[model samples]
Target: MPKRYIVEVDGVPPSPSPISNAVVVGNQCWISGQLSVGDDGAYVPGSAREEASRAFAHVFRIAEAAGFSRSDIVYVDLAFIDLADVKEVNGLFGELFPEGRRPARTVYQAAKLPFGGRIKVQAVAPR
Candidate 1:
């Protein structure tokens, strides 16, 4: 059996949800869903693309804390509050993955997200 460890970030209190901030099992790191909520618990708002950037930034921070770099990322899952933002979201993704070696990605629209956030992102990477 592989051991799964939690990677907790500094300053942010424990999550109110069931997931750890991030988890590392063996050679794999799995980051929990991340939103644009600031440390102060405020949601940052902008065009969907901007919000998507913010969300990915948050997930990237978690990946860093888990000792994984963006290059190690192998998969990504994104959920949007509205389907209308697909193109904008993909644009931001392109900016992040300009070399076209983006991790396997899945994007879908959800009715809502915590803190009324417009988008949430989760990532899987090598530990």
Candidate 2:
């Protein structure tokens, strides 16, 4: 049997709890829930719109590190603490995928997230 390799990326944020930022198995890379952590690893305060953009950017970084691109994303799971931010996340989604190609997505309202994050996004990309 071929050895299936698993990859992990951590230290993306100061999660009050333990979690993996991403995990790669075989030819697929699974990114964990991404919040609004910037390249400097700081969470900026703003509307969910701005936060989602930053979160997506952070997600792409993890994808890149896993040797994948945004175009190769196959699925995404999103969470929001409030439904009112749906429009904001949708608008940011438009800006992120202006080419009209987006991965299969599922978004839901959650009661809470690690580190008090308002939104989190998980992604799966071909590796």
Candidate 3:
């Protein structure tokens, strides 16, 4: 059995809730839901693409903090206020993850998100 450790990235705002940003056991890391919020915990206002990019940035940063490579990310769980933004968010995802090296993703139309964000993302990595 491997020891589990919580991961925290510097410059990322700490969550006001009790949730751990991420947890790692052995080679795998499960990053909690991340939003497009700045270090001040304020939502970064922008289009869905921009917001998704920031969300993805937060996920990758947390993954990196756990010693996982960006390309090594194995899964992602995305939540969106609108399903219409999937294509746009996918465009940004493709740009970041690339085609040949993409993670398995599940997208959902969320009723509402924390911080009133239009988008949120959670990730699992190191497959």
lDDT of 3 by residue, 4-117 (tens): 999988977788889888999887899999999998988888899989888888888888888887998889999999999999888888889887889898988999998889
Per residue, candidate 2 scores C-alpha lDDT tens digits across 37-112 of 6546566767898878777877887788778898888888889989899987888887677665778899899998
Positional deviation of residue 40's Cα in model 3 after best superposition, in angstroms: 0.8
The most accurate candidate by lDDT is 3
Better structure of 1 and 2 per lDDT? 1
Ranking by lDDT: 3, 1, 2
Task: Estimate the overall C-alpha local distance difference test score of candidate 2.
Answer: 0.76
Cα-based lDDT for every prediction: 0.82, 0.76, 0.88
lDDT of 1 by residue, 1-127 (tens): 8987989887443456776888899999988888776677577777888777877887777888888888788899999889888887888887787676689989898988987888888999985
Model 1: which residue pairs collide?
Answer: none
Given candidate 1, what's the lDDT at residue 65? Answer: 84
Better of 1 and 3 by TM-score: 3
Provide TM-scores for the models.
0.89, 0.82, 0.95
